[model samples]
Structure formats: structure tokens, C-alpha cells
Target: MRTQVAIIGSGPSGLLLGQLLTNAGIENIVLDRVDRNYILGRIRAGVLEQGTVGLLDEAKAGKRMHAEGIVHEGTSLAFNGTHHRIDLKELTGGKTVTIYGQTEVTHDLMDRRSETGGATIYNAKNVQPHGYEGDRPYITYEMEGIEHRIDCDFIVGCDGYHGPSRASVPENAIKTYEKIYPFGWLGVLADVPPVSDELIYANHERGFALCSMRSHTRSRYYIQCPSSDKAEEWSDDGFWDELRRRLPKEQAESLITGASIEKSIAPLRSFVAEPMRFGRLFLAGDAAHIVPPTGAKGLNLAASDVHYLFEGLREFYGEGSSAGIDDYSRRALARVWKAVRFSWSMTMLLHRFPENGEFGQKIQEAELDYLVHSRAASAALAENYVGLPF
Candidate 1:
């Protein structure tokens, strides 16, 4: 097979990139190791930055999102038994975030691809990219007990952290930085009305808890737990009990409890691989970096990476220029590092560190206190929350 670009992985990044390129009259094919249903089954963060929404619109996949996604002008931060609201729109000059599940975004993109007859080969086995450094790059994969090869101009690795894309890079050529938090988030999805119209992030003596929702009637909640904790360790009632204790009395009182529809524990980490580009092969999304979910930057960062890569490719194909492609790594990393910093700061400000002890706790309290009282600090938070400019 021959194509202009060969994308590995069918997650949001790969699918979104494919859709965007295809809509622009570019020929591309997506290869994934898993089937379509398995890809859609994974539950992920829902908060959408305005930049991400625009990318989906460019891909013609924003119809369902704009119709069903909830818009939040601001988010609330709770500490010291009080909740303070940060005005996202006011601080960011009319910018706001959309509360739409990542699953729905994937579904929309998948449907659009299907309608347009885009090429996506699912259950592709042993996918590997070869000769990415040369003028011609190609991918090989196994399917239905047969090996196949695809010749392409470029290869994009949207295959995520564990996928073959990053693994294909020589170890010495990449420099990596990572920090694993001492705690993990135990999250639950329930079919009950959210306690608050807007998302609430609480920093209490117990731990950090977040009150988020998929929609008006569906709530997604999370509480910090030990890194070793497992989902089965807590019952529905127990999870609710811990979560309520972490919030202000009023918000807790208004909370509605129900059996959890989905529950899992996700460890927090901040990671980045330097130089996202390796010759003709480029890494996007989870294949390149990971941020703690504290600031809701995971999916947003991926969208930004896609934005950069898409623009670079579009420029190369449209204008016969290599400037954008040549500068892709430096530009993408600049934004990626900022987000990494923001997420790390948020995690430090809100989470309890057993290692930090009394002194650390006092510092966190003082910082949060200043953040609410000072307009400058609040504005900074709001700006990062709404997302930095693409």
C-alpha cells in the first residue's frame, strides 16, 4: 500500500489527525493493534480546552460535541472549608472550557471517518516503522496471519506511551524526565446529578477530591489515595463517604450518591521525552509526553501536539515548504513544557505529601490562601486552566 502519511494508533490523537488530514484532501491511513470496540471502551478525562474544540471543528467532528458538551465559565477551588470560584472567562478574555468526555470525541471522529470511507486498519499486529530517517519511510504490520507493508512519505506515532512508535526511537537519542506522585486518583462514574453546576476541586485535610461530570445527569468524581490502592478496596458507599468528607459541608450536603457505573485508580505522573521529532517519524500525544490530570492537561496537550503536527504537515504539502516541519519539535516542546509546569504546580499546591510533613502542609495552605486573595495569582490559574494559546 502507498500513502502520504501512515499513522500508528487509533486513539483520539491518531484518529483526529487522520480526520483532519483527510478533510484537507491528504491521503493517510491509520493502523492500530486493537479493534475499534476495545479502543472505545477506555474512559478518559473529559475537560476540553477551547483549542481542542477548534481542532475538532476543523476535523468536522465538532457537531455532536457542541450540541452535547457542557460549557463551564469557571471552576471552583475548595480549601479551609470554603469554596472560591476562579472566573475562567473573565480572566481569559471570554475563554471557557467544554465538559465533554474523551470517549464521545473518539466516537465522533470514528463515525466521521467511517462516513468518509477513511482507511483505518484495526487489529494490525506487530506494527513497525522502518527507514524514518530517509526520504522514504514505510510501516509493516501483521493482520489475519499475514504481513503487509505500507510505503509512505512520513510516519506519525500516536500509538501512546507503550506503543511501538516511541519504542522505535533509539534509547540514546532520547532524553526523558519523569516524576511519579506518591498518590493515585480513585475515580468513579455515576448516573447522578452533579452536586455543583461547575466542577469543584477540593483540598482538604483528608486529601484532594475533584467533583466533575460528564453531563448534567452523570457525575465523575475522584479522591486521592495511596499509590498502592486498588479499585476493589473501596465499596460504592465507602468511596462516597471519603469524597464527601473532603468537600465543604454545603457542597457535600447537596451531593447525590449512586452506584458507580465505572471505577478505576489512575496513578499520577509527569513525563516528557525530548525532541518529539526523529527524522521523518514524529511522536504525538501520549507517545511524547504525559502530565498529571490535576490540571486536566492530558488530552489538551495531545490536541496541541496534533495541532502543531497537522500545521507542519499541511504547510509542507500545501506550500512546498519544510520550515514548519523543521521547527515542529522546538515549537511543540515549548508549549508542552509550559503545560508540564502548570500541571506539576497544581499537583504540588493541592496534593498532600506525606514526605513534605508539617512545613510543606503550611506552605500549601499559604499558597492557596494567596491564590484566592490575589487577583494576579487567580488570573494565572484561570489562564492555565482555560489553556495557553496554541
Candidate 2:
């Protein structure tokens, strides 16, 4: 059990980091509590920023993704019985987003790993590392209740928010930045065809409604609600009817089918932890930070972190520049803050508060209207949604 690096959590960030490190000719071991994270058909997000496409391409995993992924040049903002289309691709010079689910991305990476198999362990539990200064840093874990140990040089934390990796770092050193939004998103995956060619983000008197898709036959959507709302209580008919009410009146009512196959709720939020690195330990993906899903920044930000770390690690391995690793946290924070700000901005503009009175509602609606018509405002959104150049 000896390797150059030890990666925790095999989710998007962890997997992508493994791929990046592999390209850098650095050997690493991936540890996961789950034995296998196949396509459970979980619905997280379906949008990608313009710049994220390039990063995926460099990984060589973009080959199959580009073929299966749907590209959307524009999205709609429906209000006052009209739909406003934002030409994201046109504004960014063919720089559009792909409507691919997060689950699919994970599956693609897992498949790619088989072709480039390296040190990895599934269902590995009780993983512990000691002696960061030594060449053979010991990593001990349980594989099917059997204790095991492997030595590695450095540890990388990609295990996400709740994993033990964060706790392993010194408590006082981590500065956690977080905000709990007033609302949650009731995400539903349906058997119905898509309601539109592109995503439709609507702000209604009732709540915010999102119309997006999974594939040719599958449809995905979100309805804003209180943090306490539960999907199990929401019947299929009730969900469809409410979606219709929130959707734009002009859109064909026939677009939705009779039933939704699944429904789930996710609390909206914006969070970030400072100093992503601690000695030989480093944080990536949900292990490092989280953002509200409004701007579809979570996965992209994770992708960016791995890319930055991969470059820094390459410098450290090839040029023996520890400076690159030392500055990893600062460099990653620049992009992380950008995503946090965008996600918060989108959440505030779309969701309503219980304290909002009639005048407040009027002001909010006015802002939405302005965002629809104003080129400058739309450009601002375009820049954020497609991602700032990293």
C-alpha cells in the first residue's frame, strides 16, 4: 500500500482528480466507502458552464460525453405570460453548455478508469494515515471488515463535506464560509418529454420553477419551496398541476406527461472553507466547498480545483517547486468565491422570502423584467453561467 498520493471519495471531484494525476504520471490510490457508485439515476444537475467543456476535453473523457451530451445555446426566463430567451451561445461565440447529468459524468469517468486502472479501493473503511513527512506514509483501512494498510507520500481529501478527511485537518485552521438559503428546490425526474428546447428558469408569484431535461425521453425540473418541504408527501398529480401553474402560460401545456417517476428535495445554500491545504493534506470538491445549484457551479468548480491542483502537483513533481502546492488554496479560492457569489445572486433574485411584502414583490419583478430586456444584465448572467475564464 504505497503510492505517491492517496485520494479519498470517488465522486466527481475525486475521480476527475485521479484522471488528472494519472495524466501527470503521478500514481495515486482512491479510497471510497461505497463499493460501487454506479448509475443510481440520481438527479443533481444537468447544466455545464462554457469553460468546463475545455477542461473535460483535456482529460480525454470528453469523447463519449460530447456524443451523448445535449448542447443548449439559450435558456428562457418566463414571466408575465411571456418567455424571454437568453442566447448564451450567441453571446459567447458558440460557447454553450451541455445538458448532462452529474451521475452520467461519474459513470463516464468510472468506465474510463477501467482502461487506465491504477491503485484504487472500493468499500474501504476506517482509513487512517500517519507520518506525512516520511516516504512511506502509512494508510490503514478496512476492506470488507479486514484491516489493511498502504503507505503513501501525501494525502488528498476529495471525500466531500461529511467525510472524515476534513476532520483530520486541524479544526481551528479551517475558516468555513456558509449561508443557508430561505428555500429549497424540489427536484423531480419524470418520464415526460422535455417542455422546451432549452432550460426555462421562471420566477412566478408562487415560486421559482425550472424546466430542463435529461435526455430525449426523460425530463427534469425544480420547484422552489420551504426548506421543510418533503417530496414523499407530494403526489404525482399535485406536482404536475403545480408545475403547470408555475410554468409560462404560452408554453404548450401538452409538453408534460401524466406522471413523475421520482421527486426529491435539496436545500439551497452557499458555502466555502478557506485554506484548502494542510501540510501534506489537501481538499477537493465537496470536501473543500459547496455552492447552491442555481448557477450549476458545483461540479464545474470541483473540476477547476482538480485541474489547478494537478498543475501544481506536476510542478512539484517535475520541477521540485513546493511553492505551487503552498499556493493551491489561494488560487482555488479565487474561482470558488466567484461561484459562491453567482449562486447566491441567482438564488436571491429567483426565490421569495416570507417577509417580502407587495412593494418588495414589485421590486423583485421589476428586476426580473430588467434582466430579461437589458443586454448588460443578461451579459452579466451569461458570463457567470458560462463561467469566468479560469
Q: Which candidate is the best by lDDT?
A: 1
lDDT of 2: 0.80
In the range 1-390, model 2's lDDT, one tens digit per residue, is: 578888888887787878778867899888887766443345578577756677677766778779989988888888766789999877766678898888888877777777788556887888765664444556678877789887776788888888877877667888898898888888888887888988888877788888889887899888888888888988877777777888776664756665777789999778788888877888888988899888889999988888788888888999999888888999999999988998888877776676886666678789989997899898888878888877
Q: How many residue pairs clash in each candidate?
A: 0, 3
**Against the true structure, whose TM-score is highest?**
1
List model 1 lDDT by residue over 1-390, tens digit each.
Answer: 999999999999999999999988899999999999998999998999999999999999999999999999999999989999999999889999999999999999999999998999999999999999899999999998999999999999999999998999999999999998999999999999999999998888788999999999999999999999999989999999999899999998989999999999999999999999999999999999999999999899999999999999999999999898899999999999999999999999898888888888888888999998899999999999999998
Candidate 1 stretches greater than 4 Å from native: none
Residue 162 accuracy (lDDT) in model 2: 87
Return the TM-score for candidate 2, rounded to 2 decimals.
0.95
Candidate 1 global CA lDDT score: 0.94
Candidate 2 residue 284 C-alpha distance from true site, Å: 0.9
Name the 10 consecutive residues with the lowest summed lDDT in model 1.
352-361
Give the worst 10-residue stretch by lDDT in candidate 2.
35-44
- Measured against the true structure, the TM-scores of the candidates, in listed sequence, are 0.99, 0.95
